[model samples]
Target: MTTYYTEDHEWILVEGDQATIGISAYAAEQLGDVVFVEVPDVGTAFGQGEDMAVVESVKAASDVYAPVSGEVVEANQELEAAPETVNEDPEGKGWFVKFTLKDPAELTRLMDATAYKAFCDNQ
Candidate 1:
């Protein structure tokens, strides 16, 4: 599996033509205590960089952008009732959605883990 990061702080873990999507640990940290998560429904299509979901924290509600264009295949329904899972495990069980990738090339435009770490460092 390979992972890519968007400037907006979303992460996509690519495997074959599917990717699991979520915010990074750094983003979860910045968002504070999450209280709600709203994800796109399965079968919905979105463009790269589109607002695909919402994450609400005690700090504020924030948009979660799609790192690449794709059709939503699955959404993490568990988040609706237990959004704090995002704060506890942003990259693991806290993942927000899964989508069928629209363009594999788009992944190249995103940052790798090392670059994302550097990007976070600069922020």
Candidate 2:
């Protein structure tokens, strides 16, 4: 699996044509104590950079955008009852959706881990 990151702080773990999407740990920290998450339903399709989910926290409600074009295959239901998982493990079990990539080429526009870290540091 390879991981890619968006400028908006979303992460996508790609494995073949499948991908798991989530907010970065940095974004979860910035949100401050996530209270709720609204993930797109299975079969929902999105273009690269479109808002695909919503996360609400003590500090604010934020939109989680698609890191690349795809169709939702799964939504993390665990978040409905325990959104704090985002704070505890934002890059792991806290993931929002699993989807099939619509265009693998789009990934080239994203950042690798090193680039993402530098991008965050400058923010």
Candidate 3:
């Protein structure tokens, strides 16, 4: 499935009814190589726009937000072993978590590919 992005720069690709979430290439590039990822524990509930993880890079730390209100279902444990994957493949291998979306309406707040491009251009 193709991914959608939030103005905050989080990305989520829905598969079936669940979605896998991550930071975008724009975010990873700005952060540089990832050093650590603080993924939410499984079962933690989050509201849309809530900060869920702390992505630590060589330069600084940034919060990764929840694009849709949901319960965290899975975290990418691979990030603990090789956080650099976020820089290597921010959209693919770098996915951060998976969640069961609680409110599908939250998706309406996200940006589509074209709109995201405009948002990035303004930044």
Clashing pairs in 3: none
Q: Write the per-residue lDDT of candidate 3 for residues 25-98, one digit (tens) a residue.
A: 99899898789988889999999888999999878889998999998899999999999999999998999999
TM-score of each: 0.98, 0.98, 0.95
Shift of residue 58 alpha carbon in model 2, Å: 1.5
Error of 1 at 96 (Å): 0.4
State in Å the error of residue 55, model 2: 0.4
Tens digits of per-residue lDDT for model 2, 3-101: 999999999999999999999999998999899999999999999999999999877789999999999999999999999999999999999999999
What is the C-alpha lDDT profile of model 1 across 1-123, one tens digit per residue? 999999999999999999999999999999999999999899999999999999998868899999999999999999998999999999999999999999999899999999999999999
Q: In model 3, which regions exceed 4 Å deviation? A: none
For every model in order, what is the number of clashing pairs?
0, 0, 0
lDDT of each: 0.95, 0.96, 0.89
Which segments of candidate 2 are over 4 A away from where they belong? none
